[model samples]
Target: MSYTLGVDIGTFETKGVLVDASGAIIAQATRSHKMLVPQPGWAEHCAETDWWGDFVYVTKALLCDSQVNSEEIAAVACSAIGPCMLPVNAAGKPLMNGVLYGVDTRAAAQITELTERIGADLIMARCGNALTSQSVGPKILWLKQQRPEIYALTAKVLSATPYLTWKLTGDYVIDHYTAANFSPLYDVNKLAWTDDLAADILPLDRLPRLAWSTEIAGHVTAQAAQETGLAVGTPVTVGTIDAAAEAVSVGVKDPGEMMMMYGSTIFMIQLTALPVRDARMWYAPWLYPGQHASMAGLATSGTLTHWFRDQFARELGEGAFGVLAREAADSPKGAKGLLCLPYFSGERTPIHDPQAVGAFFGLNLTHSRGDLFRAVLEGIASGTAHVMEVCRALGTEPVRVLAVGGGTKNAVWMQATSDIGAVPQIVAENTIGASYGDAFLAAVAVGRVLPDEISVWNPVARVVQPVAEAVYARQYPLWKRLYSQSRDVAHELGGGA
Candidate 1:
């Protein structure tokens, strides 16, 4: 039986999956890694260790567990957290650790500088996105200015998936979906790189060739085959960011279909017939040509829950997350009047404030751990609601919201998200997420399956209906106010250091 291999490198983990022609997963494996925070407002990952190392380990493990012949693998595909900034030398060795996505706020100054210098209105018109922490253009400028020696030696600037593809195929390329995040450098209208905006950031040659997500990048090299335990001639498709792949995994194909990824961060992607430009949200080319996507993200979501587990629930050990979920379930709908802002890494979408801070307001001595945890979940839900509000305001509202990723397992978080957002979320059966999606994309690339067959591959498992809770309606506004009220103090604290 023909099979496909898929791998995804995420913020805190890497996952791999092997699936047969029938779309049944034969084997799956995962490896965990740390997100390095060198300083406040900075997040990074070691490309050599966390990315390539995980890829090798997971691929080998999946092959061993599945007992699939290496020659039977038709194709390989990958997706990962992006658009990250990782400069590499001539031999494709990482010059430094990869700068992470919207969570990393180290380039805030560069964002502002570029916005003023290039004209914000022009940037929005040309790039279809405003300068924010999510943009990779400013990060490129940051490296050039802050670390010129490294910049001088840089051969190519790549994101997570592109880096993996380069390792696998020895081809420097990026999918358009991931390339759109390199704002000011990519012209959304032209659907190509713009030399005018990129002139100051770096030479256009430093960028990789652009392709669609399902297009084959190149065959795996002999060296890559040796490292990955795959055939040298195995085809590797041009890969995309994890969120886009996750959207594809759950059948978010036609316009008005959306996917809300509840991973380390909360990312929302809604397919659109045409580019929908809004300063509040991002616009990008979808995985396929002639398609558009409206996107939004929160700086933190599941990451906040992880922090709570590590800091307060150490005794729970392996059961920390499950226990925390139960504790949060016990807490009342509105967390007993406590409110939180999940801006731990600064706010994204709508506000676009990199200096924004996280806070638990209305906290009293009477509150318990359950209340705090519940507040955290509700806070993230409120943020999701805000994104939905913006999407609706911009005329890109989704007819169906498909939920995926690790956070969907948390009943409290999922329920709160649906309740506070006032949107019913459909959970798919195979929400193993981006890695699974990558496998499907690989199959499609090699003509093993059609794009429309995703429904047969993984159907809707269940739906999380929005609860008509008056408390949530009342508290969401306060959640919005918490950030506004605390903005000045938060900025002071952020800058004081």
Candidate 2:
């Protein structure tokens, strides 16, 4: 039987899957890795070890576990945590660690300089995005200004997915969905790379060739075949960021359909007929040629929960998250008047404030661990609600919200998001996310399935309905004011990073 192979490199882990032509999973595997915080406000990953090494390990594990023949795999695809900036030399060796997405705020100064120099209106008009920490152009400029020695040797700037595609197929290419994150460098109107606004960042020639997410980039090289245990001529498709793939996995195809990814961060992608031009949201051409997408996300979500567990629940051991979820479930809706700002890794979307600080206001000595855990989950839900408010103001409320990811397993967290955001969420049968989507895209690349067939591949299992809660209605406004009133203090402490 024919099969397709898929792999995705995430912030904290890499996962792979082998699926038969009928969309049945043959086997799956995962490898964990760390997000290197070399300093505060900076997030990085070793391209050679963390990105590619985890990929190789996961791919082999899937193949071995499934006992699938190398030649039976029809195509291969990958997705990764992206718009990452990783510079490679002439021979494709990484120059340094890859700078992560919006979570990394090291390029804050460059973002400001470029916004003032190019003007925000022009940038929004051309790129459909404002100068935020998510923009790769500013990070590129930061590298040139702060580490010229490495910049001088840079032959090409690649993101996580492109780096994997290059290793597999020996081609430097990027999907338009992922390329849109390189703001000022990518023109949304033109649907191509442009050096018009930021010529000083890097030469246009250094960027990878652009393609749609499902397009075949190239065939696997013999070297890659040797390492991956795949057929030498296996086709590899140009993949996209993990969020986009995760959206596909859950059947977010229609214009009004939205995918709410509850992963390391709470990322939301809504397919729109036309580009939404708000500076608070992100816009990109969808996986296909003619589709469009508007995106928003919190800078921290499950990551904050992890931090809480590591610091507060060290005694709970490896199953701490499940244990914490139970504790949170025991707490009342509003966590006994406790309020939290989920800006542990700064803020993204709506506010775009890199210096935003996290806090737990209204905390009292009477509160228990259950209350604190519930407050943390509610804080993330509030951040998500803020993004939903932005969408409503723009008149693009989602017709349906498909929720997927590891966080979906936490009943308390899932209920909190639906309750706080006041949006019902549809959960698909398979919550494996991006890797599964990559496999499906690989099938599409080789004409084994159509895009709309995603519904058949993974049908809706259940729905999380929003229940009106008096406490959430009351606490959300105070949560909004808590940030506004504390901005100056947050900025004052920014220098510590």
Candidate 3:
């Protein structure tokens, strides 16, 4: 039987998945990789040293664990966070470290310049996206202006997915989804790089050709095969950003379905028959193509939980999130009138303020650390509600919400998210997320399943419905306005702290 492999290079880890022709994942592996913080706001990954290198490590490890021969693999696909600025030389090597996504906001000057050049309303109206920490356009301009020396040698600027695609196939090409993130550079309406903008925006003269995420980007080369332990000449599908791939893995293709990922950040993706554009949210092409994805992402969700556990929960010892969650689960709804904004390191969507910091409002002496901890979970759950309500307001019907990510492991947190969203949350059988979705996409590309038959491989683990309606209805509106009142103070405290 033939198998397919999908690899994902995420912010802090690289993951790989192996799926047989029938669409079931046979094996999965992951490798932790460090994110380089060169400056306070700068985040980078070494393409060869960490990104592509760990991808190869996980790929081989997955195949080996699955007991699958290299020759039996039919196709491969990869996913990575992007709309990044990775300038590679003629030989396809990164000129320097690969700057990460919106999490890195070192390009403030570039963003300011681009914002002035193209009026905010014009950019928002034309591109269907605004320049936030998310867009790659400003980052490219930043490099050209700040590091002219490296920019001069750049043969091509590639997003993370193409960087690995080039590593696998010896060709440089960007997928449509990845290209869309290059706002101000790409024209969404025309589905091509904009001549009007590209005329002045750095040299797109050497930009890579664009393709659909499922297309066969190129064949695996001997060098890639040796490094990843896959067979030479293995066909690899042009992959997409991690969020899209994960949505596909969770069977979020049908128009009304929503895929909620509870990983380092909480991201929601709902498939749509037509474009659903809102400056507050995101819009992208789906992994299967031909349809748009309405996306909502919270800048800090699980990340805040991690920070809390590391700093304060250590006194409680290991598995702090688990123990703290159990205690918080018993706390009264609304955490006994306590609320958290959860913008520890800025925020995205609904309120797109980067300077916004997290805070606990309505806190009283009666509140314990456990009550505060549970309040953080509730804060994140309310954050999901913020995104979900936006999708509803934007005209996308999010019928069945599926939860996939590290956040699902906490039963209390999952239930809390479902409660706030007012939608039942189902967990996927294998929640390794985007990498698994990439594998499933590869399996389909290789004839493992008919395009429509992809759902057979994905099954629900459990469906958690929203709790008592009265509780959610009362708390929901109050949760929304806390951000409005606290955001300014959040900014003030954030600057000083």
Candidate 4:
């Protein structure tokens, strides 16, 4: 039977899947990795190790575990966290550690500089995005200004997915979904790179050729085959950013359908018939040609819960999260007056404040750990609600929200998010996430399946409905006020640091 192989490089892990032509997953594998935080507001990943190494390991493991013949795999596709910035030399070797996505705020100065120089109105008009940490253009300028020596030797700037595709196919190409993150460099109207804007960031020649997500980039080279366990000449599609693939995994195809990814950070993508331009949110060309997407993301979500587990609940061991979830479930809604601002890594979307700080207001000595944990979940949910509010205000509200990612397993968090956002979330049957979506995209690339077949591949498993909660409604305003009232203090503390 014919099969397709897919792999995705994520912030904290890499996963792969082997799926038959009928959309049944034959086998799956995952490898964990650390996200390197060199300094406050700076995030990096070793491209050679965290990206390529994990891809090779996961691919080999999936092939072995599934006992699938290398030749039987019809095509290969991959997705990864982006839009990351990884400058490479002539031979495609990484010049330094790869800079991560919106989570990394080291380029804030460059973002401001670019916004002032090019004007925010013009950027929004041309790129359909403002100068935020999510944009790769500022990061490119940061590299050129901060590390000129590396910039001088840079041959190409690649994101996570493009880099993986290049290593396998020996072609430098990027998909339109990820290319849109190169704001000020990508022209949304023309659907191509803008030489004038790109000139301000980096040499135009250093950019990779752009393609739609489902198009075939090239075939796996013999060298790549030797490194990976796949056969030579296997076709590799030009994959996209992880969120887009995850959205596909859950059948977020029709316009107004949205995918809420509960990963390291909370990422939201809503399919649109045409681009929606708003500085508060981001707009990009969707995976399929002629489609568009409106996206929003929180800088921190599950990341905050992870920190709590590691720091406060280490005694719980492997069952820490489960135990914590139970405790949070028992805690009263709104965490009994405790409100948290989930800006642990600063705020993205709506606020776009890198200096924003996380805090637990109304915390009292009487509060238990359960209350604190529940507060954390509510904090993230409130942040997500804020994003949805902005989307609705801008006339791009999602008609349906499909929930996907590891965080979906946490009942308390899922419920809290739905309740706070006042939107029901549909969980797909196979939320194995972007890797599974990558496999499906590979099938589309080779004409094994049509784009509309995703619902058949992964149907809605269940739905999380919002329970009317007056506490959350009352606390949300306070949550918003907390940040505004404390912004000066947060900035002062940040400046001191």
lDDT of 4 by residue, 1-497 (tens): 39999999999999999999889999999999999998999988999999999999999998899888898999999999999999999999999999999999999999999988888899999999998999999999999999999999999999999999999999999999899999889998898889665475887789999999999999999999999989999999999999999999999989999999999999999998878888888899999889999999999888899999999899999999999999999999999899999999999998999999999999788899999999999999999999989988878788999999999999989999999989999999999999999999999999999999999999889999999899988999999999999999999999999
Model 1 Cα lDDT, one tens digit per residue, 254-331 = 999999999999999999888899899999999888899999999999899899899999999999998888999999
Residue lDDT tens for model 2, 1-497: 39999999999999999999889999999999999999888999999989889988998898899888888899999999988999999999999999999999999999999999999999999999998999999999999999999999999999999999999999999999999999989999999999999899999999999999999999989999898787899999999999999999999999999999999999999999988889999999999988999999899997899899999999989988888888899999999999999999899998999999999999889899989999999999999999999999999999999999999998888998999999999999999999999999999999999999999999999999999999999999999999999999999988654
**For model 3, how does the per-residue alpha-carbon lDDT over 67-129 read when each residue is reduced to its tens digit?**
889888889999997767899889887899998887777776777788788878777766778
Model 1 poorest 10 in a row by lDDT: 195-204
TM-score of 4: 0.99
Better of 1 and 3 by TM-score: 1
- Residue 113, model 1: Cα distance from true site in angstroms: 0.7
Q: Candidate 2 clash total? A: 0
Q: Is candidate 1 or candidate 3 better by lDDT?
A: 1
Q: What's the lDDT for all of these models?
A: 0.93, 0.94, 0.81, 0.93
Q: Which 10-residue span in candidate 3 carries the lowest summed lDDT? A: 195-204
Off by over 4 Å in 1: none
Q: Highest lDDT: which candidate?
A: 2
- Model 3, residue 306: C-alpha shift (Å): 1.3
Of the candidates numbered 2 and 3, which has the greater lDDT value? Answer: 2
